[model samples]
Target chain A: MTSVEHSPLTRKLSAFVALTKAELAVLDRLHKRRRIFRAGHDMVHQGQSAQTAFILYEGWVCSYKLQADGTRQIVDVQVPGDFLGLRSVLLRTSDHSFEPIVDIEAVEVRASDLLEAFAQTPRLATAILWAASRDEAMVVEHLVGIGRRDADVRMAHFLLELGARLALVGMGRAEGFDCPLTQYHLADTLGLSAVHVNRTLRQLRERGLVTFRDGHVRFHDHQGLVDLAEFDPAYLDQTGPLLT
Target chain B: MTSVEHSPLTRKLSAFVALTKAELAVLDRLHKRRRIFRAGHDMVHQGQSAQTAFILYEGWVCSYKLQADGTRQIVDVQVPGDFLGLRSVLLRTSDHSFEPIVDIEAVEVRASDLLEAFAQTPRLATAILWAASRDEAMVVEHLVGIGRRDADVRMAHFLLELGARLALVGMGRAEGFDCPLTQYHLADTLGLSAVHVNRTLRQLRERGLVTFRDGHVRFHDHQGLVDLAEFDPAYLDQTGPLLT
Candidate 1:
């Protein structure tokens, strides 16, 4: 583990503090700086005690669950400035697993520290709970997508959503954002076959709606993709100076 | 329209206020009491502008989403004092519809009323938002149920969950609750055919696990249902008296 002097860790904590300054400062002070992980590493395991919650400083992480048969469902993907393990934090039990998808760095705060901070700052409690609520809502929207929408629409909707979220955190460029995700990951998230994900991605690229290579994606026609996906960001309810 | 002068209404409001006093009071003041509807009336429609949220004062309601092809998924059933339209309130649009299963009395608060109240009380705001968050999270759990668990397990899980929620608001008795529902309704909720629901209900009955007929259900062996469903109430997170 290194000190919080590093750029990635500093920037991420500052972003969370921007959302709830005084409270997150309490969290930031309690956090112990942790070493960066390589592209593939498990931060938490399913059914195990969730000891800490992470604020993703740099790179991506995924929250997922696995079946007895070894099949996995990627419940969510966490990017920079996103809060991980908030659901488990409230539940007092871990329901999913977390894995870093790229070279990763984060500040890990103990559950006790989080509970102490929540006890002191009601606003932070509200913010974290709201964050968890929004996370669950995203899962609801995804359920609707997979249960009802056609495959093409589902894939397009996912890409559009990823682009929007990444753009909000300044990780995205003018055209698109780095995907930094594989077809296998997309398959697990969307509940599709890996081959189907690959084909869909190819279709998206061939239509000139998006471009992706080497883990980076560039939207050639962002509005077109939005239309194709029938995407509307309204449910996100982006509010206040905090999320901004 | 009339005042909430009836005992049932008062009792239902009490449960809500018990969990969220001043906030529910603000909400209670907003409603102009309305007549209970017959079994078939639609409370809200999918893809429609949702004007208000409702709390069941007596009887039951069902929340459901309809497909483009007209297939319906009855996601959750609302018992006495249960919350509905909160999802629509949060999203600013209704993506599903609801209807009374019987003649049902309810208190309705306009979304404006809720927003105004939130503006005044941060604690109330947190409570309502947390309530909505729980609703949204239940929908996610439903997704997991259908996507992963088998039919019998799903049915058992659904019953266990409903019973718990009903118990929370005092609709359920110590041992079991009056079922207050039909096989068809359970079928729709579980994404199964009515015949399948009937068969599963029979299975639970014959195994000395449950008893149901004539709008009443008793858990003959409550632990059996728990084991059958792999039921876990951790997801409910029904803690904290601040917001009930």
Candidate 2:
């Protein structure tokens, strides 16, 4: 395939469309190439309309909401092959913000264009619907993590889940992964203090459950970490494509 | 209409069917009317197949899950004209339990049946997709309530949202409503102690915001309560028929 066909936006959609053989031509036509943003650039604002959906090709981004008191809640991390701005498409409004954590290259697809394609292809529509459900389930799991689970369990589950998702998209290695997420972002996500997050990471590394350094994580005993987190992957059953 | 035509289950389905005529016939055939235990009976267990989706026709129900230590978290409250078991419908497995809060009459639709209807009707499929999305937004709001809002604000938002949803299906009065939920259930839902819930209710009544007695609640100053809770009705949009 030509480099144009192998672009990150196309790569992301193709990964999905390859499973279902659903219509991608419309999306391909609507695709317009956009440049990379430097680290610390804002991709989406909390209260503004994020009219574009993005597929992260390189680098990382954080979805978060800021409070009036200068506090922030980091909601989710967008990685390669992951599309952010999906939840906003349904609401026709944006309720969160996205900021690039590193120099980022991503593909942006207009919501209207995607909806138009969905209107034409039932299979594509089904796939998109399933993706949205999977996204919501992730949020629910996060709620369960923060509301009920202890801090250690929450962090372990987050790492395990992230590794699994990234591996599925061929972004992570089998036993370890590249996650350029800072302890500050992780703390915001788990509703803990940054100091607490740093301490937890140190403990994990000391105990050999996982080791984090140089923007990479090594899962020394994946099953042990899962057992500690009580992590079950059943909540994420985006299996419709596989089933068909 | 004849009495059979006006059956509670039939009436509820018809109201939902009014919005999706094509999908209604498909759903009607798959729907089975069954009477299980009366008020306070568990409809579905956690970690089960989640084979059936219930549409409440009379009385109320709730969805909840428990931690390993036996602490319960009430996820959602279901009343007449509402579709219970929606989360499990997509997940294909019940991660939560469903129980009727009062003497309940409902129709159970199998998941395979709903999926068939979704495959056949475009509008219905779109509505269901939107229904799931709307449920997600509610979950997000709940997270905010649990993590950020005060006790009184959380309770007020819950009551007003429930009132608006129930009123849509002709189950509530102009200024009040009958929900049949217990203080314990309310406490679990709000993540507050029972004593705290009681005190908050007393405060609400004393402030002329709301009045509750005998499972019925009356809003003294609905707008005032809305203002206090910062309740936005956009989260409860009824653009769809049954699930919304």
The top-ranked prediction according to DockQ is 2
Candidate 2, residue A185: Cα displacement in angstroms equals 1.6
Model 1: per-residue Cα lDDT at residue A108: 71
Score each candidate by Cα lDDT: 0.67, 0.70
lDDT of candidate model 1 versus the reference: 0.67
**On residues B1-244, what C-alpha lDDT tens digit does candidate 1 reach at each position?**
3443333434433332343455445555655655576787898887666756777777899887665567677767777656666655544456568889988887776655654655555555444444554565567667666566777888888888887777666678757888778888887776679899889888888888877788877888888899888777765655434223
In the range B92-194, model 2's lDDT, one tens digit per residue, is: 5676788888778777776556656655664455555555666676777776677667899989999988887776666777699976888999988888899
* Candidate 2 residue lDDT tens string, A1-244: 1233544444434433453333545445544555587889788786565556776777788887665557777767777656676655544456668899999887777655664665566555555555566667677677777778788888999998888777656677868998888888898888889899999889988888998788889999888898899887766653333324
lDDT of 2 at A77: 78
Candidate 2 regions exceeding 4 Å error are A1-42, A47-59, A67-70, A81-83, A103-120, A238-242, B1-37, B110-112, B238-244
> Which candidate leads in lDDT?
2
User: For every candidate structure, what is the RMSD over all alpha carbons to the true structure, in angstroms?
Assistant: 6.0, 4.6
